[model samples]
Target: MRRKGSPHLVVIASDPADAHFCNVELRKLKTGAIVGRHYILRSDVQTFVSMYRRDGFSPVEGGNND
Candidate 1:
């Protein structure tokens, strides 16, 4: 979700890996305030969390809190 006039956007990607990647991109896209993109990775969160080993956190497979 995103709110108009907000400094930052809420990005929701398809998975944690994408989310993590998006998070980095978002920051890089804008400095202080400018065009922005937020991501929420929920579609394949399990794989997202696991494959993205950089964060040291992963979601359980087949777990759908959605």
Candidate 2:
């Protein structure tokens, strides 16, 4: 379930063999369904973090922090 007005970004490992790689997904908040996705390398993870930080993105209450 998703909370209203919360961030829609989701990051997860889609392949067991490529654990270091992750899929960055944009999901519909109401449906919890993925609307878009992109695979990213582990090294690029920091890029997203930096970008989100720059954009003032912050975790919501009860949201996953790890």
Q: How many backbone clashes does candidate 2 have?
A: 0
The global Cα lDDT (0 to 1) of model 1 is 0.37
- Candidate achieving the largest TM-score: 2
Per-residue alpha-carbon lDDT of model 2 for 1-66, expressed as tens digits? Answer: 133456565443344578677666667666879887778886776786566566655555565423
Displacement of residue 62 (Cα, Å) in model 2 is 5.8
CA lDDT scores, all candidates in order:
0.37, 0.60
- What does the lDDT read for residue 10 in candidate 2? 49
lDDT of model number 2: 0.60
Worst 10-residue lDDT window, candidate 1: 20-29
The residue ranges of model 2 lying beyond 4 angstroms of the native Cα positions read 1-7, 12-15, 60-66
Per-candidate TM-score against the hidden true structure = 0.25, 0.62
Candidate 1, residues 1-66, lDDT tens digits: the string is 223343443233444544443331222215544355435444444553444444432333443322
